[model samples]
Target: MNGLEKKQDQRRRFLRTLYDATGGRRLTFILAPDIGTKLGLTQEEYTSTTDYLVGRGWMKWETLEGKASITPAGVDEAERLIAADAPQPERRNIPAPVIAEISRAFDATYTHAQIDNIFMEASAPGAPPEGSKLRKVAAWLHRINADSEVDALDIFGRLVREFLARPRWGTDLDPHAAEAYDEEDSRFLDALAAHGLSYHDGKIFGAGLLAPSKTLAELIRARDLTAIGKEFERAADKIASKSLGPLWKVVQRHLGIAPTPELDEDLKRVLGGLASIVAGVGAFRTHAGDAHGRGPGAPSIEPRHTRLAVHAAHTVVTFILETWKGSK
Candidate 1:
């Protein structure tokens, strides 16, 4: 085919993939890399095709980040083309990688019996026959996704948070899961309160900071990687705002700078660096978190990564609080 023909083919495939993923009813974000791999397109081809569609107002995407969603126009176009073509087979089964990721997460925290209990609670009619918990659970997930209206992955995610909220333990649940992390979190809050900053309705009043740190703690406990990265990014944005914006005045006072209407370039650079570090947490979330749809090829985020993110947030917030208090 000629250049224009190849380009059109790629565009059609891209739009079709997005439509299939979401039934064109919802705007679902898909990673650019996944689209490229699935379509067997070169980097240049992917870039050119994405830009063309986005320019034509057929989709919304940040080419730099590779997170994209088809717009209504794009959906209409895809639908038109689909109707002109022969009917395609419906996709029923959940991707194997997705199923494996869910299974690993469940197995790590729940024993075979607990798995059975969760499955029973979450599954609709026609639960799988009793047998190997691992094999049976996997089989049931495939069956349900193929046969039921509800998406299998969504059911598993809901099941996780529900069971995790109750007091319980599995054979493999981390013994150290209940370690002094809460104490550290409490101390951080106490330190803020000591500085006369009170938290209410998810914000620290005096600092004018959106503090979702507590939410992060709960997500960490639940081991919900999907939520953890997104929450971390949110908390990081708030901290970064304080570090880089008007709060910089307070920081300057603490730095012993004379009252001046103008910002000192040198000090700004230093603060900017700190703010960037804070923002990096959010960046991490965009890449690794389930705030957006992750492709099956994306590596599963681990418990250690969540712990690291939480600790990093704690450290940054602690530093900011200490600086603000010292300025008083």
Candidate 2:
């Protein structure tokens, strides 16, 4: 074939591979190398043809973060082309990789039978021929648990919040998961109040409680930790650790506590460890915190990573407040 013909074939193959791999989310972003290898195309072909395809309305580039999902028109054309090119075989069972991906994405272990049942429902009449994985999973959950009164979006949205495969910045953690964290925040405030350390006037020995606590709250809500992570650096200054470092000195000097209480040795060690836990939160905020820009090649923050941050912060605050109460 001529060079022009070869180029056309390469583009066609790449689009097809992307369609199959993402299961027609109509939108998905995958790594550049992965895309190139999957379609057996050169780096130039995969990257270069994106604009051409977009102009033709075959796909839309959502971000510079390596997005390559098909547009609505692209999906229609892709489906038609796929149908014409090959026979639609019976899906007796869903692909293992697809199931495995879902399992890993949601951290919920699922059996093949469970997945197959979901696949059957999703592939029912009038349903999308090859809907996205979350859609199928969501639909299955919505049907099986109608008595619970939860919708598919929440059922699936929780999955996305926990482990959406997309490269995006946002999170609204499930209420069940956030209960402990909320209770800890409330307890921390209560402890502060008991010690006359109001959040508004809660400074001890010149150190202060966290202000605009909204930064972490926003991080949890929107999963846009980079912006909130940036704010954490500033918030670090308010908490007496001078930027999430060891909180011992801050707790002692600023919060007006003894260097070491005359408690049992074991209890002292535990309290010291708790103080370190608080310091660790600060250190993470300063070091590997997602407070900076994650340009084209950067990855979205993992749910587990954010959980670590939130959990650590709450644990530290709660511990400090309790310790302060004990001292008084």
All candidates' TM-scores?
Answer: 0.27, 0.28
Writing each residue's lDDT as its tens digit, candidate 2 over 250-313 gives 4555444433667678867866676677667665655555466334554344435555666667
lDDT of each: 0.61, 0.51
The TM-score obtained by model 1 is: 0.27
Candidate 2 C-alpha error for residue 265, in Å? 2.7
Question: Which pairs of residues clash in candidate 1, taking residues 3 or more apart in a chain or in different chains?
Answer: none
Residue lDDT tens for model 1, 162-262: 43444533424765645433443355445445553433212223322324476445544655455435644555554545433444444444444433447
